[model samples]
Target: MGSRNGKILFALVGVCLLVGAGYVVAAALGPDETTTEARPQVDGAVLAHAHLMVRAVDPANPRLNGRVYEIDGGKARRRSGDLACERVYFAGGRGICMGVAPSGVDYRAQIFDSQLRPVHEFALTGFPSRARVSSDGRYGATTVFVSGDSYLQAPSAFSTRTVIVDLRSGERVGQLEQFDVTKDGKPFDAVDFNFWGVTFVPGDSSRYYATLGTGGSHYLVEGDIAARSMRVLRDGVECPSLSPDGEQIVFKSRVAGSERWRLRVLDVETLADHAVAETRSVDDQVEWLDNETLVYSYEDDLYTVPADGSGEPQLLVRDASSPVRLDRGI
Candidate 1:
């Protein structure tokens, strides 16, 4: 496995050097960019659980590169760094960053400890899209577009592959495609299976929830990490995010007969679904801000709504894409 990983990294580096050498420094970086020291206090119970909510500060200014910033209270605390990435997630007390390396061809996953100490790095395939960490921070998952991110047509249309990693042991837990799948108590196989938007169940590193696409349709898949297996739960589910209590999952659902997708929540045990109050077309993996509200990014800004399908979606943070609140109060 070491040799195989080395070869893959070698190939990724070669490709990036050939195609993205001039652009790697110009991408949006993960939240673990070099640190900046500033402490500003803000307010609200939503942000009270943690010390900082980290995200890319200047996603709009490519000239500034991927600079890391934190929201303390509600004010911006800028950090220093030029590292570029699309997203970052904190789990197991570690920061996992997914971004294109200096060589654009190499999608890299860089892990850092709570003190910002470097731990491990993986040269991955495709363009970085989303990064997620299990509640305990033992497991990390990332989604990358393997193809079809460009304007020019390609062989694969919007193909995505989700990779899970064991952060503590620094081992790749295998991609979602390798999982054995069963549908309706029978084995199911497909030549066109693609997965993305994985949400992990807390206190259980062995299980996760994700969106699986096959035969031109999408379904929510309940995955068993230890068994390397998956089972289809329901149709029309995309980007499932489990609530803090692990009793519910918020996701985006495709409306019937149209391309529009609305925010919705599902009761994992009862299989009951409720459409969130947000009626706009949202294409994001919504995050749970406490047990009642769901936060997500739409049009470069963050918005929140009630999980029970009650209240309208309201803006939380502007010019931010990834929003995370620490479970422990500061």
Candidate 2:
């Protein structure tokens, strides 16, 4: 009996040693590779509620064209679909993509939900350019070039029509030229009037800001959607984007006697103008990341500068354009 008891003790000690050795081997090999539960920290970070800076990459290749870059410096993933467009934006939990139809003759406006599922679509009149969605994503606006509407001498340059759509109802809101104008509180009309660069007021779908051109001059106009009317506010400003707080408007202002435009900000309350930090001439429409930082695309690369005109331009993403931030917190 004494010999049997000693043998049992020796067997239990051997099993304990084997269990300890197995634990040491597993620890050295790191976590289990089979489960996401044991995935690396970087893998989990890609799943967060982060903003995506999307842009067209590889202009020559049709297969790997557009890319969606994670804001936290994670890997950029290519977007799948026939979504060939100059710009794409997301707002109010919806994605708006503007481009030419596959037929190459008809322009198209495609709308998608947060999950990127097709929710709405429209057939536009001409080649699509810039696109903007209102803060709440209820209204979508685009600038396109129509042939007959423009002067024959400069068919493309002279004719630009801004179209606003009711995304909720999937209906057209008519061209900005159709809106009645009250310049200096009096009825204003012009046969050559044109409108582009729409910026909607936050929480107010009826109100918006846009650039109106008449008699070879551009003016900033305040628009009322329900009334279908506009009031001219200021001149020499084009492609205005309202700040997040709704207090200021940033736009491209033509430099006198030169064919160049500089980014400038206007105080909506005082109608005061101030230049942004970037000194180089900017040709594209700008977006506000917040009240302090302004973003725009320069030569196919995305850049940001301080709205207060303080810091130098910082590169946000390479080979990207149409930087739109999703106000998920709203």
The CA lDDT of each predicted structure is 0.67, 0.66
Clashing pairs in 1: 16-105, 28-85, 29-84, 29-85, 91-137, 92-137
Q: Mind giving the per-residue lDDT tens digits that candidate 2 earns over 211-313?
A: 8877657889999888888999879888899998899999999888666789999899988988988989887779887787788877656677888878788
Q: Candidate 2: list runs displaced more than 4 Å.
A: 1-50, 59-70, 73-75, 78-82, 154-157, 328-330
What would you estimate as the lDDT of candidate 1? 0.67
Task: Give residue 168's error in model 2 in angstroms.
Answer: 1.7
Model 1, runs deviating above 4 Å: 1-52, 57-65, 79-84, 148-156
- Tell me how far the alpha carbon of residue 285 in candidate 2 is from the true structure, in angstroms, after superposition: 1.2
How many clashes show up per model? 6, 0
